[model samples]
Target: MPKKLYNIDFYKFIESLDLHSFTVTDVTRYLFETYSKEFDNKKNATQFVYRHLKRLSKEGIISAIQGKSGKAIVFRWCTESSEDSELVHRTEIYGNKTNDLIVSQLQEKIRRYKTEMLMSVGETEAYSEWVQEMPDFAEYVKPHYQNTREQAKLMLGKVKGFERLLAEHEARLS
Candidate 1:
């Protein structure tokens, strides 16, 4: 027998938390701790959890019960007899929208980073070329050239990381 394939679903995770009320902070901590593989860091985990919380509230699956107290907004799941089907429908719709938003944002970041990367490339070239053509200033320009090259390397890593995430998200959608 072969094992079945499975992917972690954020909506399902939220639904599994059978709590009467919960705050975004609480959920974020739990999510970040439990799904360390899915998220790169706590900040990303918090953002993902927050996005779903807002969507769930908008869909009436959850309602805000706090925040008027000047504290974290707590949410309560609205349980009803028809919740299963309705929950599935609402989450499915909102989930796709959320995913689409994430994809678009990632694309924008990739574009911005690529632009910066190109600028860094030009700076790196200019600095290195200046060092050879103007040997008297090489001592001062060498450090700048090395710094620009290092920055370009870091930006390339970030671009690759974003591309990997984009691919994973697209694959999940299909």
Candidate 2:
């Protein structure tokens, strides 16, 4: 039941803003504070704002300029349309085979797998320490330790495979 940013009226959000130009961080913080219940967390708010900004740029309502730091992007409101401007949604954006949703979903999966792998590593270490402290319990702890290590290995493989797939998908889109 996650809230998707594409469903929100981002065009109206942009129009309501007083700033002519802003970075994603600025918009993310504003939205996170204004729509705390909807977003639930800063990360979710940031992703929602970033997606909307990208869609705005794509629709020509805003222009993305290079920021002082070469890697940073700044979005400037380029159009002076009336209040009834057409709302920009992800319907068009997600129509393509390789879209933001797919890329973000893949990245989220990779992050989850990496996190689980790290947790598994921690569990393996704890089990190793327990076994060293009490050799008599080695027989009981061996299965758990081995299973955690194997799961960590499996997670690593999954992460690498997904990363490769993501790269190939991005390359194809490019």
Candidate 3:
């Protein structure tokens, strides 16, 4: 799938453009002139603008106005719909660097906790079976098994907390 590029920079760039209608070529030229460092070449920059224009049109962020000849497509920045503007704002917030960092950290913590829980469960089960067959070794193995169980419980608690935090963040975004 094509990577979505509705990032803060893109949002700001689109916002900076004139409200009047513009052709893809006009937008591409403007982008190349204004932010040449962002694109490797004019061709790539033009492609990026084309894709962005199509996406924005689909999202109702911009309206495409067909010209007289039917060959020219002029795009005008659209803000007539409050819902579309709100969606754009929310998208910007979700793509913010701080939110991205928090999301990454939460995902990492959740993954680590899940792995630890699986390992703890495996160890505890092994110890339980070993203790059942060998009662003489129960005293030595029981403590370790108990420790694993406790660790697993703690991990589960942490996982639940992280999940709640993530859900709250998502709710706020929505």
Candidate 4:
């Protein structure tokens, strides 16, 4: 039998953080220290904390501000007693429809690039066959065939990147 996965109400967890503003790293460390026994390791606990924070921010349950260096993200807890209702309103607007639009665009790009890569593969195969049948034209066909393969590789790379982006967006939606 498989172990069942349990869902944690992260909003409640965040609420228990006691209305204190904290950086993502600080939150991760705090969770890891509090629930060290529940997780296999600190890294796993940290990742879990990050996942919840992202979901909460995306759903407008919390507000995140980019740090001065632009790499560190500080998350502010939202509560009924919060002083800045306007800031909360702005945060609510953050993940509304723009994420969906970006996800849709990324999916479309992934689909188109995948199809192009397949076509490029077919063209490369045809070129190889032509070169085999006509040795004299091999010089002319070889460079084009290589170029097509390179193009296919680039397209595949793009598809992977777009797929990753789509997954991130979907995670936020979830």
Using lDDT as the measure, which candidate wins?
A: 2
Please give, for residues 1-174, the per-residue lDDT of candidate 1 as tens digits.
553222657667877776678899989988888888877678778877787899878877778876777878998877641557776867888798999899999999899888888899999999888878899998899889889888888888889999999999999889
Instruction: Locate the minimum summed-lDDT window of 10 residues in model 4.
Output: 1-10
Residue 146 of model 3 has an lDDT of: 97
Tens digits of per-residue lDDT, candidate 3, 54-113, equal 987876677999987899799887765355665766677557867879888988999999
Q: Which tens-of-lDDT digit does each residue in 105-134 have in candidate 2?
A: 999999999999999999999999999999
Each prediction's total of clashing residue pairs, residues at least 3 apart in sequence or on different chains, is: 0, 0, 0, 0
What is candidate 1's TM-score against the reference? 0.50
Q: Where does candidate 1 stray beyond 4 Å?
A: 1-86
Ranked candidates, highest TM-score first: 3, 1, 2, 4
List candidate 2 stretches off by more than 4 Å. Answer: 1-92, 95-98
Q: Report, for every candidate in turn, its global Cα lDDT versus the true structure.
A: 0.82, 0.83, 0.81, 0.77
Return whichever of 1 and 3 wins on TM-score: 3
- Cα-based lDDT at residue 106, candidate 3: 89
What is residue 42's positional error in candidate 1, in angstroms?
49
Off by over 4 Å in 3: 1-19, 26-60, 65-71, 80-108, 167-174
For residue 104, give model 3's deviation from the true position in Å: 7.7
